[model samples]
Target chain A: MNRVRRNKTAIILFIIPTLILFCTIIIVPIFMDVYYSFFKWNGMTAPEFIGADNYIELFSSKAMGFPRTIKNAFILAGLSVFIQLPISLFMAIVLARGVKWEKFFVALFFTPVLISTVVIGQLWLKMYNPQYGIINSFLRLVGLDNLCRTWLGDGRTALPAVFVPILWQYIGYHMLLLYAGVKSIPEELNEAAKIDGANSWQIARLITIPNLKPTLQVCTIFAITGSLKAFDLIYVLTGGGPAHASEVPSTLMVDMIFGRSRYGIGSTIAVFIIFLCFFFAVLIKKVFKTEVD
Target chain B: MHGKIGKGIGNKVIFVFLCIWALVQIFPIYWMFTFSLKDNSEIFGKNMIGLPHVWRWSNYIDALKVGNIGRYFLNSVFVTVATIMITTICALLATYALTRMEWKGQKLANSLIMLGLTVPIHAAILPVFIVLKKFHMTNSYWALIIPYAAFALAMAILICESFIEGVPRELEEAACIDGCGVYGIFVRIIIPMMRPCLSTVAIFTFLQAWNELMFAVTFISDSKFRTLPVGIQTLCGSYTTDWGPIGAALVIATFPTLLIYCFMSEKIQESMAAGAVKG
Candidate 1:
C-alpha cells in the first residue's frame, strides 16, 4: 500500500492530461480574455493596447448598444425568475403531491431540455412564420386574424417572440430541480399537516414552500446565470436581428469578433459575462444565506 | 357529501390541466415530425398539425443528399464519440487521482477542476479560437473534441468523485495484498466499479458535444467538418422557401437526443439533480 502511495509516476500519469486540457480550455482562456479586453485589434493586425477605452465605449456609446443588450438580458433574467420559476414551482408542487403519472409528466416536460437549441429555434421559427405558421393559422381559424402579426419580423414583437422559446424550453429543467427538492421533504411533515386540519394549499404554503428555499435558491441562480449566458437559441432564431433588437451579450460578442472582427471589444464582453455570472452567483448565495439565517 | 363532490371535481380539473401542459410540451415535437413529411404547400395551407397525407420521405433524402446533412451527421457522430471517450477516460482517472491518491497540491488541482463549472463556454470562445488558430488546429476534428472534453471534465469529475468515494477501500486493500500494483488496482478494481458513473458522464458529455453549435460554427468553417446543429442552421438559411427539408433536417438532428430521452431519461434526470445539488 505504501509502495502504491509513493508511486509518483502513477499519480502524475493520472492527473496531468486532464489538468493540462482543463487549464488550456478553461483557465488560460479566462486570463487571455481579460488581457485581450485591454487591447484594440482586428483579428488580422497585431493588437494595440488601449487600456480602458473598450470598457468606456461599451458603457457610454449609445451606438454600440451594449447597455441595450444588458437591459435585454436583465429582462430575460427577470422573466426566468418571475415567470419561469413560478410555473416550475407550481408544477413541482402538484407533481410532488403524488399525482398519477408523475414520472411520465416529469419526463415529458424534460424532453425540450434535451433537444438542441438550434432545433428548438428552427421549430419556433416555422411556428412564427407569418404566412404559414401554426400560430397565425390557429389565430385565423379562431376568427382573430387581426391579432396575428409578423412575430419575428417586427421589432415590437421580435423580442418577446424570441424570449418565449427560451423561457418555455427550460420549464422542465427547473421543475425537475424543484421536484427533487419537493420530493426530498419527508412525507411525515405533509401527513402531519393533513392530520392537523390543513388543506392541500395550506400544506403547500406553510410546509412545502418554506422547505423549498434551498432548491429555489439554486434554481434562481441557474435561471439568472442561464439567462446571462443565453446565445444559441437567439442566434438561430433572429441572429439578434431586425436591427439588433434582440441582442444579448453573447450574440453581440460573436458579432463583434466574427462579424466585425473586433476581438478586443468581443473579449471585453466575454470577460464581462464571466464577471456577471460570478457576481450573481455570489450575490444569490449571500441573499439566500441571509434569508435562511 | 357536498365537500367530497367538490374535492373530486377539483382533482379532475387539475388532471386536465396537467394533460394540457403535457400537450404544450410535446406538441412542437409532434409538429416537427408531421411537417417533415409534408410538402411546402400542404404544410403551409392544408395540413398544419395533422399527419402528412402523402408522406414524402423524399424530404429526408433531400436533406441527406442536397443539404449535406449526412456529412454533418457523420461529423457530429465522430466529434461526439471522441469527446465521450476522451472525457470518460480522463474524468475517471482524474477523479481517482483527485479523490483516492495522496499527493501534494491535490487540493489545488481539485478546486481548479471544479472551478471549470462556473466558467461559461461563451467566455472561452475567443481565446480558445486564437490558441487553436495559432496551432492550426482550427477546422479540424481535434478543435471541437479538445474543448468539448475539457469543458465537460469538471462536471464529470464532480459526478465521478462522489461515486468513487462510495467504493469501499477494503477491495483496494485486498487487491494490494495480492501484490497488484497501482495501475493494476485502478484498471481492475476501480474501472469496473465505475461503469454507472462512466455512462452518466458519457451521456452528459454526449449531449453537450452533439448539440454544440457555437464552436462547431466558429472553429470549423469548412463544410466538410460542419456538425449537425450548424448543418441544420445552414439548411434553414438555404431552404427558406422549402422548409420541409429544414424540418426533415431538424428531425434528423434531434432523433438521437430523443432516443436518449426515451431510454435513459431517468438516469439523466438523476444525474442532473445530483449535479445541481452538489453544484
Candidate 2:
C-alpha cells in the first residue's frame, strides 16, 4: 500500500506539468475552436453568440471564398498523394536496392526539408519573378518564349507555380519514409524472386510492394493531412496571392483571424480545417484497411 | 546471361533518373547562392545560370545593414535552445514515469499525450493567442517558448518513451540493488542509455522551433522579438524589388539549417521516420 501510494504520487508529479501544458496549449484550444465558431466576435469586443451564423456565412457567402480555399487545399492533397507519393516510392525502391552515392543523394534530397519553409518561399519567389527569374529566362533561352508567363504573379500560373517549391521541399520526407520501409524488407525475398528469373521491376512489384503497404498508408495519410494544413510556404510566397489564386484553408483562416479581426469567422475556418484533418485522417485509415484485405 | 545485360541497362537508367532528380533538388540552392552575390544589373542582365561576375560580398553587408538578421538569428538561437532544453527535460521525466513506473491513470496519460501529436497548430493558435493576450504575454519570449515546448512535448515523449522501453530493466534493477533511488537510477541509467534518442529528440525540437513561423508571426509582432523565419519574411517583403539582398538574407537565414542537415542528416531522417511510424 505504501509503495503504491509512493508510485502514484511520483507518477502524478512526473505527468502533471506536461499535462497542463498540453491541455492548455493543444486540447483546450480545440474545444475553444468550437466555442468561438458560434460567436460573432473580433479580438477586441465581447463575443456575441451568433449560433451557426458564422458557419452559414462561411459556406453561403462567396465573399470569404472559403470554398475556393478548400478546393485549392484538396488539389494540393491530391497532387501529394498521386503525383508525389508515386515518385517518392519509386525513388525509395531504387535507393533501397543499394546504389552508389546513396548517402550523398539522400542528403541532397532531404536538405530542403531542413531549411525553413519561409526561406524556400523566398527562393522560389525569386525564381518566379517575371523580369529576370530563371523560369522565364530559361524559357526564352529554349525559344519557348510564348510558353513563359509571370509564374507567380499571374493568377493563371500562380496556383501551380506555388506547388513547385512545396513539392521540392517535402519529396525527401516522403521518400525517406518509404525508403525505411523498403530497407526493412528481408533481402532474401528479393533474392528469391531474382533466382526465379524475375527482373528488378518484377521483383519490386511482386515482392517489395506488398510488404510496403502499411508504410505506404502512413506516408499517404501524412502527405494528405499535411497538405490540408499547408500554410507557411503559401503565406510567404504570395499570401495566397495573384488575387488569391493559391489561397489555402490555413492562409484564409489566418487572413480572417488576423487581417480582418473576424474572430468568429476565423474560428469557423479553424474548425473547418480541424474537421478536414480529422476526417481525412480517419478516412485514409479506413481506405487503407480495406486495401489490406 | 541475358540477365547481366538487362541489369546493366537497369543500373544505367536508374543512374540517369537519380542525376536529374538530384539536379532538380540542388539547383535552386546553387542558384540562390549565385544570385546572392550579384548586383542588380548583373542579376537582371547576366546569364541566369552563371556565377556572379565580380563575386560582390556587399550584398551580405547591405542585407545586414538594412535589417535585424543578426538580432533575429540570436533570438532564434535563444528560443530554440531554450525550448529544446525544457522540452527534453519534461519529456524525459514524463516518459520515464509513463514507461517505467507503476501507477494509476497511466493509460489515460499515455492516450492524452498521443492525442496531442495530431493537434494542428492552426486549430489551437487562436486560443493560445487569446490566453497569452490575457496574460499580457504576447510579443514576449515566454509566449513562443511555452507553446513551442508544449507542442513539442508530445513528439519528444513519444520518441523518448519508445527508447526508454527498450532499455533493459536489469540496469535499473541493478542500480536499485546498489541502493540508488528513483532519481539516481534515472540519472545514472536512463539518461545515459537514452543519449542517442535524446539527441534525436533534441535535433527535431531544435529544427521545429527554429523554422516555426505561424506562432512567431502571430504571437510576436515586435521586430525586437521576431525569430528568423518571421524576420526573414518581413525582410523579403521590404526588399522585394532587390533580389540580391533578399537572396543574401535568405542564404544567411538558411545556412545553419543547411549545415546541420549536411552533417547530421542520418539522425534527422531516422527521427522523422520514427515519428511518422509511431504516430
Best by TM-score: 1
Instruction: Summarize candidate 1's per-residue lDDT along A1-293 as a digit string, tens digits.
Output: 87796689999999988999998889999999999999999988899999999999999988789999999999999999999999999999999897779899999998899899999999999999999999999999999999999998889988999999999999999999999999999999999998898988899999999999989998999999999999999999899978889989999999999999999999999999999999999899999999889
- Quick one: best lDDT, which candidate? 1
Best by DockQ: 1
Q: Each model's C-alpha lDDT? A: 0.92, 0.86
Candidate 1 has a TM-score of 0.98
Model 2, runs deviating above 4 Å: A1-6
The list of candidate 1 runs beyond 4 A from truth reads: B1-3
For each candidate in turn, the interface RMSD (Å) is 1.4, 2.0
> On residues A103-158, what C-alpha lDDT tens digit does candidate 2 reach at each position?
78877887778888888888888888787887888888889999988787889888
* Residue A57 Cα positional deviation in candidate 2, in Å, after optimal superposition: 1.0
| Tens-digit lDDT track of model 2 for B1-279 | 456788788788899889999999889889889988988888886656788778888888888878668889899999999999999989988998888887778898899988777678898888888988888999889899989999899999999988887899888887877777777877898889999898889888988999999999988889999999989988988777787888888899988887877677788889888877877
